[model samples]
Target chain A: MDEEYDAIVLGTGLKECILSGMLSVSGKKVLHIDRNQYYGGDCASITPLEELFKRFGAPSPDETYGRGRDWNVDLIPKFLMANGLLVKLLIHTGVTRYLEFKSVEGSYVYKGGKISKVPVDQKEALASDLMGMFEKRRFRNFLMFVQDVREDDPRTWKDLDPNTTTTQQLYNKFGIDKNTQDFTGHALALYRDDEYLNDPAVQTVRRIKLYSDSLARYGKSPYLYPMYGLGELPQGFARLSAIYGGTYMLDKPVDEIVIENGRAVGIRSGNEVARCKQVYCDPSYVVDRIKKTGRVIRCICLMDHPIPNTRDALSTQIIIPQKQVNRRSDIYVSQVSYTHQVAAKGWFIAMVSTTVETDEPEAEIKPGLDLLGPVKQKFVIVSDYFEPTDNGLESQIFISTSYDATTHFETTCLDVLDIFKRGTGEDFDFSKVKLELGEEEQ
Target chain B: MASVKIPEQKVILCGEFGVGKSSLFRRYAFNTFVASNSRQSTLGLDHINKEYTVNGKVIKLQLWDTGGMERVASITSSYYKFAEAAILVFALDNPASFHVLSQHLLDIVTYAENAKIFLCGNKLDLVGQVPQVTDADMENFCEQCHNLISATFRTSCKSGEGVEQMFAEIARHLVNANRSRMELQTVDKNSFKVTPPEDPTEEPACLC
Candidate 1:
């Protein structure tokens, strides 16, 4: 059969799916194909509990675990920030109609052999057990400055050059101790390492504000999760693409990516030839074009109890700063239970993930996993992270980066926007997206 | 916390591609039918919640439309996890789409396993003009495919025939199944309210 398209995407990862949806909305005839029959390649959620065990090659769960149908376990657990870029994209693209979301209950950070709630607002700050009275005053003042200081207003700057001054100086200016700085940076700003301290303070300041604003939106926490799992996200975007005239073929494999004179012209899949001007795909689709970046270790734990000292939050995130654990990168522990219908009633799923630093990859996430009181069943995987070395300018073949160790979508959204820019050579203007998130699904 | 519980049903529409599955989906869901050609082919898993009052109980149908192109993994992995009902659609005018009826039935049995599956013969308007698979022929084919088809219908999105009746019958089945499950839930001691046992698992998303 002879068919042609303006662009074709080769993988069903979240990053690739977002690009496909955005491209289709831009009025391009897009064709999306995934070698795997399911969506969200490495980042898929396995349902029926038995299927997950099958994927891990483990034995079927006993009757002690509830019915298999009640579980939708994400192999890679992550939470979406309420006011983060991903939510904005969801709203802008009008994918919200296809899904329902519940607010997460708490945001916690690990400190001094224990876990404590993040003080997201003034009320929480005054009652925070992590800080003393005087320190709370200093921290409050610092937060007030952050709340009041507009980057554009000179008076709000208070003589700190956000563009030129490092975040370390800003911390020193407020005399906020290191312990408080750890939670604010690692949990609030959600930075993986201390490197942001060395960079300009503007982005960090903005991130903190974003976190607080997001927390304020939902109050309990700044996170919202779909009823099923993160797997629903790719499906939502896939529906958007289809609404805009994009073609999809799952379980379709590419025999050859026909490059005519160093440009992606067409794809050959089992005698079906569909021409396209450009191609977009995840790193696994085109290995030669990407370079090995690093490795990530993810531990998925099934527990009968909530994480210790999280105030028994139904859904929560706990960040372990690198300095606290004497490591290079921070560890993230995210937990979800039946409240989101991801797991069976009274069952919880906690995942501890971190960037692999040494050969003993499993040992790196020990601090994060220790928070879970008693895990009934655990599945662990270590995968290499990759990035496209060349930007696909020469070949018109844009490739997405591998999924990272972090349990959030900010970094994933960044990768999506970056690929969108490289593929279309224009920034994804959010204003161009109609404010129609409330459009009736029917 | 005050919460209003809504009864929900997960229904999957499974069949081969280009069998007019999207039209049936848009018809049953949107209640606004655009012809078969203008509608875009479904991508991935497309689902919508349509509320129906069955026997005085407001039941929400969580209709899942598989792109009709997904392979075996999509079936084995995610689609059948909690599906209480499945509507396997086939085009009446195109017997080729009907040829795969056995395969779809086998998959629904193997994956969905216990779901109440109904067969729908779509494009009834095109059936006579396009020269024909009879309604009985479709039922005979379903019976040959292991006697698994729970009910059958002849629907046409063009003329708005049988589409409404097909869904109404499916809803009746779903409501009956749900009521039995609820009754069984009360009698069965295994049923619990998913108490807050110090920790919960239904989780959501957070920050960077």
Candidate 2:
């Protein structure tokens, strides 16, 4: 079969699927390819637990990890509606029945050196309570104001401007309390440090209103997650894309974008040359591959046992310290899963810190697992950072950096061990933890 | 060779950003789903030609999709000129956008005084979160605004809800308008003999 087509989508992510699906539905022949062996990209799911169990000679999930076996893929509906191609694929492939997701409720807040469980329905109330602890009225008012903004509407220029200044300034102007400010501040961090709010005040207000409204409307409240895992959301889209006449090629990395004048004509993947008319890339990969500047680092940690002593089984936390980590802002830690089908009957926590430098050597970096257990279990840490590389095939380098870069590389690991010791009050044996670094496949 | 006389009808789609304007067009014209978002702005205007038979004669209905977020006042102003019928979409979850429905309706009324206007709320699947905008609410809103429009439908492009009803309403209105135009033209004996237009799908740029 000829590899030539009317349009070629560069990445097999959510956005790529939509662009390719729309063009194909419009009668344009389309082809989609991804560098990763799997199609979902960031949303890809693999049985890492099985691999880890094999390495450790551990018992199977039934014999060891026994918690929630059912996985719910939330956000599937929103993703389908957002992309056009997925809808067409569902209809063409008769796979609509496979699309299902369930909503789960959970919440967490960091206090007294550990994450405290909070009621999902009462998160706003808890936020309000937190606001009361701080003596700032303006911050309180800002939270109330955001709560009042309508999200479902098409926000105008007057809605979402972020030039409002420091959290203190916003608090003063709005007459909000300190507790509310901290809660709002922490929420802002979770949404990636007010990136969307960097607009004008009006635009900022609009986005805050939209965010608030979506929360209220969806019953998503302060936070939400995919029912099963994040991966299921994009996986559904990939399935639909293939059901249509569109073709998705995985494990075939595109070597170069065959650009012709100013427009893209085709791409060279390994030895194969796939041709198309238009190409759409996933937004993250766009920076280095398309724009060439921005960088991203993600860390995943798997624990053999659940964190100790939480009343609720499933609550996630977003930690913002009073000070900086490595000269950056506060450290951001999130507990991804307590117990799920993918992990051995034990609990797993995935903490991601963007502050760690990507280029640092693994030997120089210290690795430590700080367990704040009300419960005890085995723990594993996996840190990956991305930086632009020279090789066309490599694209980016993923390295494990020292937890603290200021100290000598060899001593950095010891600093991390000390930080976790002071932070968690748990006597963890670092000798048992294994640290390894390698290239992370895209 | 005998030739059939075809009547002409005009239909227009209007809505706020992200409300499924392009999806509605694809649904009505091609019986297919066209995924669309507010982020990617519509470059220009889209015109689709559709044909149907009425009273033993052929009739043509031209479906036009106007930009949803075009410096609002400008895009709507240009679209109203030739529009004989309009679909004004409002998002139910977004009350702010729904509030702007009056501005769009007024634009159409100012330009095409006699145009048939239909108010539709897209994303009916999200209705559980955002309650359906009842006919009474629309009636009260329209009464206060003094805009006596045509019909309203709660639609979900995802579930294919209210899509057929919307297209049927427009088709029926257009067919009737065509019959009236042909009758009026027939009375003017000096009018030139008209020929039916070719299929619209044949045009490359017509789809976008």
Candidate 3:
């Protein structure tokens, strides 16, 4: 307990676990602790089907749910994009070996009161039913243009300045209709709202290109889910940390974060004080340093059938754009079934989450619920999303933001990278991380 | 480092802090024991990947340690997931560790659900000096756990007595228990591959 460490992480959340693993791999001694007995902190996946019901204060599950151990229900479910930064980080850190992944069955979007597959590439654009014959060609040309626009090559810019052109301008150049822009913006780019349309088009172009590139990698959707549940992710990183000599403590209460001269020195857990140079934790640990930005409402629905109009995909992601649902925020529905081993046989778990903009949080996700046809059980959770008001420079305490309403881990990865930079005062170098095999004691 | 692939079973070592779980792990995996510097050398190793031949069949057992994180019941439930066997170690010189065996058994059955429990009374060399935990204590603890424990072993990392036999017994039981599952894995074997094939979707070279 007296050994000094480079960093003391306060939660076992995915972001904190990843940072701890990375730091440990870089040869920095780290100590990670959590108050809860289980891992995954705020984003843990409850198992046995009974625990989830108990956590939500719902009635105990009857025998109809089948074997209790067969279900792994994630509290804050998120899908990882195949070409997303998170997957790249997994491979980079060599955590991929500890876990397995299955590609998501499809990526669909809700439009015209119906769900349809999002057209990412030129081929999908031409064959898409969401668009008219003329709009399809236009959207295809748009996709082709996006594929060609390179950040380094001026010739691929098509006379439009990548830096100066707004997303609205990019849309107008290809004559992409309103509906085309809606699905393209919400589904492919995964924008929470239309705010990005007013910003520079370079980021949007890169996002859509990323979406297409990820789709090209797997041929289905760009998303990938772990075999068991999202719970495996944090544990995978924790194991990586442990292998790299990072210590972990769970079910241990962290009484106080010792701060000296406005900089973190260590953590005080009872009578013992474990010293560290810096501290990393989730927003909940340092509530005074965090500001509540908004609340996200999520409904975990247990169903016997796959999401309607999804071709009976075993796992899929569906986004209901803000405009279609006539809301300020988009509603995201992510479905996973027994194929991924997250549910009992013939049982599917669909989660509908979004930023809470109204008083009736349950009513806000009604559109997402209506898409599920019939649900066996539902657990609703409304959690406040927090962001750090104080960065690590002064306090020497880096805090990760709360999980957002997005179904993908893109934003989560961005937060991780940002926190890494702020905590270490250096950018995360991808090239330095070798995809080495698991080392063994000889 | 590329070796013949075998079935990997995750076997976790659970006990109180300083119960010589890591020492037992080191004695078996590295086959060396350091009384004073036991914890330092093993901190760098997450789990030991040891290949054992049970009934003429090779099985790779991933022996995992608690990293002394279980001292305050701080070990994560993730550590129990997918575990095929759990080695519940206790110090024969300390009756307290023996008394807490029921609590550890409760945790194993609660989290692991299906992991075969193997009771281990470590520090067997200390038994020569008036033993604090007698054989009756072990028998009583086993009776309380009742039908849950697969087998029991007494070993000392110092004298290396019964150390090899304990692991062999574990491997033999696991091989017998999961023969069909191992055969199924033999039909579809896979070695580790870290990198994906040259990502074809990667953009072409472009000079700024």
> What's the TM-score of every candidate structure?
0.83, 0.45, 0.88
The CAPRI classification for model 2 reads as: incorrect
TM-score of chain B of 2: 0.74
Model 1: runs farther than 4 Å from truth? A269-273, A429-442, B1-14, B25-86, B93-118, B126-152, B164-208
- Please identify which of the two predictions, 1 or 3, would achieve the higher DockQ against the true structure: 3
Worst 10 residues of 1 chain B by lDDT: B189-198
- Residue-level lDDT of model 3, residues A1-442, one tens digit each, is 7789999999998999899888887778988899988888877888889999998898999988888888889989798877788888988877776677777888899998998887655566667789999888787788778777777788899999878989999999999999989998999888999999999999998888778767766657788888778998998888778767788788889899999999999999899899999999998788789999999999999999999889999888999999998999899999999877688889999999999999999999999899999898998999999999998889999999999998888888899989989988888876655534235334
Which residue pairs show collisions in model 3?
none
Off by over 4 Å in 3: A1-5, A67-69, A119-126, A216-219, A245-247, A253-258, A266-276, A429-442, B1-5, B38-41, B53-56, B129-143, B159-161, B183-208
Q: Residues A403-438, candidate 2, lDDT per residue (tens digit)?
A: 221101122223323322332244333232121111
Ranking by DockQ: 3, 1, 2
Order the candidates by lDDT, highest first — what do you get? 3, 1, 2
Which candidate would rank higher by TM-score, 1 or 3? 3
TM-score of 1: 0.83
Candidate scoring better on lDDT of 1 and 2: 1
Instruction: Compute the DockQ of candidate 3.
Output: 0.23
lDDT of 3: 0.83
